[model samples]
Target: MSYRNTGTLFTVLVFLFATAGARAWAGSQSKLVAFTVDSVLAADTNKGIDVRIASMGARLRKVFSYTTYRLISRQRRRTQCGRMTGFDLPGGRILHVEPRTVVGDTIGMELVLFQGPRPVMTTELRLKRHAVLMIGGPHYEQGMLIIAITVDTPGSHDVLVHEPRIHQHQRLHAVSTPGQAP
Candidate 1:
């Protein structure tokens, strides 16, 4: 083949390879969404936000207008799309998350907060991979509860160390603080 023909073929092959790589990455995106649920108590206890959520303290303060924000409990889970997953919050409430679809890099899901037998708040959310969403306003012991839901990075099913699987019955340690014994 001539040099011009060879150059044309090379350019075509490079374009094909790049397109294939992009498609492969999109195909490999998992159907799973990892959720990190943090239940925080917000009141005038003067403790401020806990270390785990201190990075978002400014947002919490501006929204909730509370003096203290303490993490009461945290739970993690990996749920599939079209399936509903529940997390137990303080004051005997349940926050249900149902992941629906992943379009591009955004994960869409529905969330429902249930108090006892009644459903309180039901809404849908679209979040980018690795973003945190906070939902609050449930009365608890001394203060209200602010629940933070963090969506892990896409295709992170392999690196989940502390998540509860929705399908299997596996035994795992409950989430604990740094200095506390598990």
Candidate 2:
């Protein structure tokens, strides 16, 4: 083959090899976000030690592409996994609040409370984490609602809690699984 033709062929082969290697390396890169739950129970003070007594329910509407909802009844065996036991909701909607899996580093959730057709209230929450997030919630009373979330991380993490800038009650706290101090 002519020298020019041979040189052109070598350049094309080199470019192909470089492109393939780059793609293989990118595939091995760690996922941008991941999640996990603690096998051991959190400390009594860190857990939902019945600090408050209340009942709340919501109908799950598929806004995001992926979400899992489980109904949990207080009467059932209350344990770590049993957190999502059982109850009931109108229109056959799931009632229990269980651990959820949200892909990507940022998770967005919206909940609305309806009393027969008329909308009573709505809530919007955002979660951003590098690891997994163990969440439990939908607790409510009168017009007050609370969502408890436990984040899972093998390393010490700084969680950012965002509320209105004008609100003084906005704050962030950390706790760990039972036995371990945060």
Candidate 3:
């Protein structure tokens, strides 16, 4: 074969391989699940307490197609115990969560708050399927810092969100903290 023809054939072969490899890599990626994180501020009062939800509404409306608010009703609080799942947060903070065990409608999980990379505070939480799990701070401004996590699993609408509760009946497994000793 001529040199010019040989070069053209080689280029086409390389392009075919590259397309096949790209498809394989895309197929291997794990499907991502959607979840919501809300930060709220609460203050203690003589009557009881005053609660204020942070402005996640505007942001949610922009990012998500469907948005709704659901109040957290039943929650089981716990101290530091069990395995941990590390979640990277803003301002160089990390949130570690460990789901221990579940009983009936309640699911137990441990949370370890970290600044930079060090563990600052550790606590346990028991949450339901559609409950908001609140984590407050030692103190931020006049009110306490509260981080509310709502697990919004996709239902009939699958185009916008992916369901996180695919295997609800599966046993809870411990996830190792990223960039830390196991």
**lDDT agreement with native, every candidate:** 0.74, 0.32, 0.46
39-131 per-residue lDDT for model 2 (tens digits): 112222322323121111111111111122222222222222113332232332232323233334344433344444554545554556532
lDDT of 2: 0.32
For candidate 3, write residues 28-57 as lDDT tens digits.
322222235544333433223222222343
Which ten residues in a row are the worst by lDDT in model 2? 56-65
Give all TM-scores, in the order shown.
Answer: 0.65, 0.23, 0.37
Error of 2 at 140 (Å): 8.1
C-alpha positional error of residue 7 in candidate 1 after TM-score superposition, expressed in Å: 40
Q: Highest lDDT: give the candidate number.
A: 1
lDDT, residue 46, candidate 1: 83
Residue 52 CA displacement from its true place in model 3, Å: 15
Ten-residue stretch with the least lDDT total in model 3: 70-79
Residue 89: error of model 2 in Å? 7.0
In angstroms, what RMSD does candidate 1 have relative to the true structure? 13.2
Model 2, runs deviating above 4 Å: 1-48, 51-103, 129-182
Off by over 4 Å in 3: 1-35, 39-83, 138-145, 151-182
